[model samples]
Target: MTTQLFVPKFRVDECLAQVKECLEKGWTGMGFKTVEIEDRWKEYTGLPHAHFLSSATAGLHLAFEVLKRKHGWQDGDEVISTSLTFVSTNHAIKYAGLTPVFADVDKYLCLDPEAILDKITTRTRAVVFVGLGGNTGQLDKVAQICKEKGIALVLDAAHMAGTRYRGKHIGYNADVTVFSFQAVKNMPTADSGMICFKEQSDDELARKLTWLGINKDTYARTAAQGAYKWKYDVEDLGFKYHGNSIMAGLALVSLKYLDNDNSYRRQISKWYRDELNGVEGIEIVPVAEGCESSTHLLQLRLERRDGLLVFLNEKGVYPGVHYTDNSEYEMYKDCGQCKNSVKASNEIISLPMHVGLSKNEVDKVSCLVKEFLKG
Candidate 1:
């Protein structure tokens, strides 16, 4: 395809080097590399704990379950969140037997805190805020609301691998923060995610819950001086959600160069801003105050967005939408309806975004966008 939606460029030397080490060791199954990745993630964010999972969805579900256990969650409990996010966020809520209460989004495409203010009811126990398009839209306000109401602030930071708010990482702000290292994400790792909890106790619980509710992970188990044993306990109903060694190796290699790669992505976004500044009928999303985003996905809100998308495709620019309304999905047809969400979903379109996309490619795409608007 002439227009690639997302192309994750790997440093072959770095990845192959790690692979060589793993091959030499001949023990590649969610052990040393996984621990290293988690340690590096913790170091990068200055967080006390980190757990790597098979995917961001897995991390979210595990986080939800941990929250449910810590707070005694029950069926029909409500989690206030934005409708502009991917359905997986709501799916996590559903999987935990809790309801997702949809809230409207502001200009940043992240959840609107004021809208959240209006929606808080007696049954609302948590606010699952998605850092949509890597923007932390009024997250501070969301945090304040959650704290004042004693509601858990769960963050679905799928697009924000390296995002920061006021010099602090997104994970530091929310009670529990989950990051996706999916194939298309800035920090690609085949597929993996990191879940960090605010409290050590919750972190302890999450570790068990992600690994079949076993108190000791395989890595810890193998460290015993005598008898590498199979003796285990299923303290809480858990799932097999741990990230394997291969994915963790990739994540470790990628995490080392994440900031460098993101600088390129940021430059591409800046190029878009410079090249398409003041294009009629096209609006570029702005940076949220005090937020430095990873810019994983560049989303546009434009008039005749569908037409623009078609035009881009014809010109060999295979851009896509970040998401459609969850309520439109048959499985989630019963999801809370927000008229603004429908409007936002229709108007928003995702442009080509990745570190491998050259500045010249970004300029070409930017020109195509302007030409489409002219048409």
Candidate 2:
């Protein structure tokens, strides 16, 4: 049997129980459950404002758009970003008509703060920091740099649902933070995300902008005045990015177990660390000092990444690569250099990590890795 890189295990009974409520009530779009989940997220993260969205991608795009419009940022303004992240992170920058300037990654596969400081220019408006694989890395340093430079910070926390730094949630200091509850993320929903903004006004503005720029969403209008529910105003052009009640329902169910689930993922990482630490020709990625990571992935840096990938596949222990350098993409070919990111992009591989992943399987994979590297 193949030991897959990721296989999300959902609590089916719990998920159905929540979805059944939405079906019986017949208000399955953008209201009841979404509102509930938004509240739950705020309570869980202790953030000031949380808005549910169709996906993390939408949340990230809206973050850039709102910040750009609010600050009157012109097109071509730069947002420093890690090249070693999902394309969605950078795509959001382009969607807002801003440029993405590539930044090198640190040992934790996160944006290097020194690299960020080096890249700042007159046009640099914000920095998009990705807590890759749920590890906070040097995000605190990055946050401080942004604060001192008077630049905005947008955290692409797709892999950081339960991740915490210094006993507080990861988003408290960020200008905007987006979290994914996609099919394969630590928090599994069909697909959805939460956007938490530091400012209440920005959160309110985001609510309108997500639903085609309407002043009052259908749920809000219905609750206020029955007949006037259909009446609303459009303030600005927006996308259909609001999440539905069904995804929200699933998310609520998943949220109930996120902590325990993340705890198991950390245990699996511990096993990987015990088995592979200090092995020659390989380097296990390090989590940040203060991060209680959700352990979304167990990644390693190997000199022969492609060869080991093929070797693992032959053994029915398939792994994955977190990302390719975004600068290598045709759309971003001219983005500035990211030497560390380029090195990491070529050398990194994500090991099997999920609730279903077994310790025995982790040991087997590590043994094979040791065997291959020794050869």
Best by TM-score: 2
TM-score of 2: 0.99
Q: Give the TM-score of candidate 1.
A: 0.97
lDDT tens digits, residue span 111-177, model 1 = 8888898889899989999888788878998899888889999999999988988988778768899
Identify the runs in model 1 with alpha carbons over 4 angstroms from their true place: none
Clashing pairs for predicted structure model 2, backbone only: none
My TM-score estimates for the predictions, one after another, are: 0.97, 0.99
- Cα RMSDs, all models: 1.4, 0.9
Candidate 2 has its poorest 10 consecutive residues by lDDT at 220-229
* Residue 107 displacement (Å), model 1: 0.4
Instruction: Report the lDDT tens digits of candidate 2 across residue range 1-375.
Output: 899999998898988888899999988999999999999999999998999999999999999999998999999999999888899999999999999998888889998889998899999999999999999999989999999999999999999999999889899889999999999999999889999999988998899899999899888777895576688889899889999999999999889899999999999999999999999899999999989999999999987999999999999998999999988889889887688889999999999999997888989999999999987
Error of 1 at 13 (Å): 1.9
Model 1 alpha-carbon miss at residue 48, Å: 1.9
Off by over 4 Å in 2: none
